[model samples]
Target chain A: MIGVISYQTGNARSVLRALAAIGAPARLVASPDDCDDIDRFVLPGVGAADVTMKSLEEAGWPDYLRARVVEGGAPFLGVCVGLQVLLDHSAEGDVDGLGWLSGEVREFPSSELRVPQMGWNSVDVKSTHPLLAGVPSDSYFYFVNSYFATVGDDDLLATTEYGAPFAAVIGRDNIMATQFHVEKSGPAGLAVLTNFVNFGKAA
Target chain B: MLTTRLIACLDVVEGNVTKARRFEDNIVVGDVETVVAGLYQQQIDEVIFYDILASAQNRRIDLETVERVASRVFIPLTVGGGIKSLEDMHLVLDAGAEKISMDSMAVKNPELITQGANEFGRQCIVVSMQVKRVVPTAAIPSGYEVAINGARVFTGMDAVEWARKAEAMGAGEIVVNSIDQDGTHQGYDLTITKAITDAVRVPVIASGGAGTVAHIAAAVQEADVSAAIVSSILYSPRMEKLTTVAELKAELAHDYGIHVRPIVAA
Candidate 1:
């Protein structure tokens, strides 16, 4: 079963509903013990980086997630702040992230563009990955964020431009994440989630 | 590049979706669930629901309707009207809403914005303003005054100034609804819309008076707003002609060259 991590950060219900829409058997992982039956994991978040980290830490999710997904080789996905927490650190609240990927989350540089890039924006595919299997070219996804992840070239899966190009989608080994809201995004986003559900399963 | 967002605003009263002209003469359109389900199928970017009577009646928001509607909605859902405290925000958010918009409460208790932003993140807190056009005066330099209680009471505050304050107080977004243009189906009030958009750094949404696809295009082209909210154009049978979100987005892309999310076939 695919497990969607739930906490006080918000938007977990939307993610759960999206999984149900795709005919995927999923349940909310409210605690670390809920991780046992969850083969594929989806961490959906919508809040500040510091707040998301604190809630996850309070619930003892960081170590369990790192052990199961990062080291255990189970497929994992993160959305919005979920994606941010996977990085080494975030400038949002000068807080540390889960450090699953070697990167830092920083606010979009002072520019003419708005700070939190709220609304729909297109994603440019950087390379091939199972998570993007049925996602169309130039597909747009819902984005509501002030910070973007800066990852190494090898980990970049897709890029989108606000003021400057930032990592919109990143994947390394068994872990993948998107800076946009896959659940709120239209059909293209559902396509991404569908691929993620079938990603590591034996064909 | 970020595309312009087209949002559908559902003015709900009691338990059914309704429409009003200039925030009066309410007419029931359809049940909340069916109308929202149709909008979803049309690939609307976002949806906003305002409980029109909750605040005037002096009560909490209708969480039952919110929870029922949110169960089927996959896109971002923003709910406004009757949100009075942090507990109210929690109740609405827990009912599955992505964003909680504060109108009457925000103007009365500015701290609610900061509190909501601090607790739930600024992105989830939206400050919606009801502005009515008035003669230019020193007290109202922008020639527009903020209204509340379904636009029945004028707050004597300048629309542009209030927007700036809300943003400073940690409102992630602002929705400026023109009391005069609402339900008129003429067009958005561009002057005030542009002024507030210029005054704030966060995204501003132009609400009220969306008649045609061109009107929506003008809000982005002339006013430079990040998004536009429409009601009668999509749902009102009383309109001369009804349109779908797909048609609007297509016209926006084909005629106006406005970047909109491509509609995915159902």
Candidate 2:
């Protein structure tokens, strides 16, 4: 079964609904014990980075999730703040993130563009991966975040531009994440989640 | 590049979808669920569920309707009308709404905008203004003032100035509706829409007076708003030809050389 990690975030319901729409067996993972026997995991969040991290730590997610993704090499996906928390730090909450990926989350530098780049922007792929299968290049995805992740060139999967370029999608090894909300991104986004479900299930 | 959005505003009363002209002459179109599903089938870009009587009647927003309609909608769904406090915003967002819009409440208590933004991110708060044209005054130099209580009371707040304040107060987006042009079917008030759109950095949505496909196209190209909130143009059966969001998107791409996401038939 697919496990969705929901630790006091708002997007969990929409994420699960999207999964159900695609006929995938998924359940919310709210505790350490809920992380057991998961074929793949989705960490869905729509809250601030600091608050999400605190909630995850309070629920013993920092330790449990690291073991699941890093040590076990399980296929994993993160959405919005879920993707932000994978970095080393975020300017939003002034809190340290899970640091599973090597980077910091910073605010967009362009004052001309509005903060919380709220709308649909086109995603331009930088490199290819199994998780990106069927996701059309230049396809628009809905985004509602102020900070964008900063990582090495090798980890960037796709980038989108508002006034400046920001990482829209990222992947490294078994870890996959998107800065946009795939749950609300319509058909194109549904295809991304379908690929994630079937990515490593071949094992 | 981000494309212009076509949003459908469903003014619901009791439990059915309805439409009003200049905030009066209410008429029911269909059940909220059925109308919303039909939009989803045709692939409207976004939707707003405004409880028409909730603010005037002084009652809580209808959460059951929000939950029911939201279940059938896949795109971003925003809820408005009678959202007086953070608790009301919570109820709507928890009911599967992506954003919560405040009309009269935002003017009466502007702090709600900051509070809502701080607690639930700025992107969750939408400030919708109903504007009416008037003489230029010190309070409103733009000659367009804000009206509340369904256009029953006019506040001497300039539409352009108020939009700037709403953005500073943490409104992620602004919806500027023209009272004079509402339900007229002539076209959108491009003057007021352009004034507000040019004055703010955030996305602006123009509402009121959409007669035909050309009107919507003009709002997007001339006014340069991020989106247009249309109602009667799509609902009124008296129009020469019925228009769907699918047809609108296709026509936009063909006429103006704009590209919107394609929607498939359900």
DockQ (Cα-based) for each candidate = 0.67, 0.50
For model 1, residues B1-266, the per-residue Cα lDDT tens digits are 89899999999988889999998898999999999999988889999999988988889889999988877777889998988888888889878788999998899999999999999888899999999999989999999999988898899999999999999999999999999999999999999999998999899999999999989999999999999998999988669899989999999999999998888766
Instruction: List fnat per candidate, in order.
Output: 0.60, 0.32
When candidate 1 is compared with the true two-chain complex, its DockQ is: 0.67
Candidate of highest lDDT: 1
Q: Output the worst ten-in-a-row residue range by lDDT, candidate 1 chain B.
A: B67-76
Name model 2 segments beyond 4 Å from true.
Answer: A33-39, B263-266
User: TM-scores, in order shown?
Assistant: 0.97, 0.93
Summarize candidate 1's per-residue lDDT along A28-141 as a digit string, tens digits: 889998677889889998889999899999999999988898889999999999899999999989999999888989887535777678998988888788888767558889
Worst ten-residue run, lDDT, model 2 chain A?
A: A108-117
Indicate the worst ten consecutive residues by lDDT in candidate 1 chain A.
A107-116
